[model samples]
Target: MAKPQDLPLELLQFYLTAPYPCSYLDNEEARSQVLAPNSPINSHIYSELVRHGFRRSGSFTYRPHCDQCQACVPVRVNVEEFIWRRINRRIFKKNQDLTVHHQRLVFKEEHFQLYLAYQQARHPKGDTDTDSKEQYVHFLIHSPVNSELIEFRLNNQIVMVSVIDYLDDGISSVYTFFDPTQPDRSLGQFNILWQLNLCRTLTLPWLYLGYWIKECRKMNYKIQFQPLEGLIDHQWQPLAFAQE
Candidate 1:
């Protein structure tokens, strides 16, 4: 396996995207430093990129590079040190009947339908809610690295799906969508708990959770999981605010 320092210099080259509308913040523009499209991205290279605060969207690997704003902070869970609060334990117990299946990155109609429903219910009229089949396929099914699709089924019915990347050091939670109507099920929280357990079972120490924005209500749930470390100033440190 190639180490981070052993990666070819060409792979380090990046393309800065033109400022686009910020997804998390209103009326603000955002830019990304994206890896060159031609560069070969395998598991090891992507693992190195994640360690440097980058995230994968489909086959694209990029990180926030706003010219003046630095609101986006990469975060990961110290799975080995994760604390299970009362709510977390309750969520785990509630989801005990759900069966888990690990799958490859193949296109499945049922998964797409569930994703569409989730987007419409949770993010109605948002960017992904109106996605066509091709767009949905391009968004989640086109990974070039080691990725897995975890399906959560209840009574043999698909209830949720999580896309995860297997990093050299840990697992990266790419994306998760669940049956929005089942709020009581707390499938999202259960999925994270399951990933944390998986990390322990695999003896991995971290669970990369992409980026966290303090002001984004959609992201507020991330900090609730204890022992989260954020990438700040190129260093991973325990988020002081999260400690509270």
Candidate 2:
């Protein structure tokens, strides 16, 4: 593993944010090591940052920097050796009807509408459920790297949308939102399966899935893809060893 300081990024600086309530865990607090705002982060610099367990949210690159807990383990899937479980295969089969379209990082009313509905349906109790159009744009559309917006449609109706960043070594699944009404379709799992295929198509070896917390039920889905690796003690290791 290489230190982030050794990366070829010039004038790159990191600062720890004030502790706040943890989003993934209950009754806990969390902090993040955020890259300096307005830092010149391009695809090359971001690729190195991501390799070091950092993730992009809007124009910010950050990683979990909790003081007492190391629950947020950065994880990625090895595309070459990813095991397609029965459930994964079923999910792929189920979403075979969805048509995928790659779009630029421009704002789309249709995408915003779906995103709003998804937030309301999936996370009614969450703060983002009531986000305005400006907030949506700032969160998902604003980027400083080579990012892409992909829409998954079924019969001309938008069903899901994914924001992904293309790194030198692989594709990063930044954020995904789907039609929460069709839970039986398992669009979320299908999204990961689709990303794996996209990685293979691009000849990339990894698919960054961001942080995974075992104690968080929502994040447990990340481990469903077998042979996952997690960043532990600054080293990437198998999920089992990383958890330990």
What are the Cα lDDT values of the candidates? Answer: 0.91, 0.89
lDDT of 2: 0.89
lDDT of 1 by residue, 1-244 (tens): 6555478645477999999999999989999999988776789888888999999899899999998899999999999789989999999999999999999988889998999899889878787544788888877899989999999999999999999999999999999999998999989889999999999999999999999998898999899888999999999999989754
lDDT (tens digit, per residue) of candidate 2 on 103-158: 99988888888888898886888775448888888789999999999999999999
Clash counts for the predictions, in order: 0, 0
TM agreement with the true structure for every prediction: 0.95, 0.93
Error of 2 at 184 (Å): 1.8
Which candidate has the top score in TM-score?
Answer: 1
Among these predictions, the greatest lDDT belongs to: 1
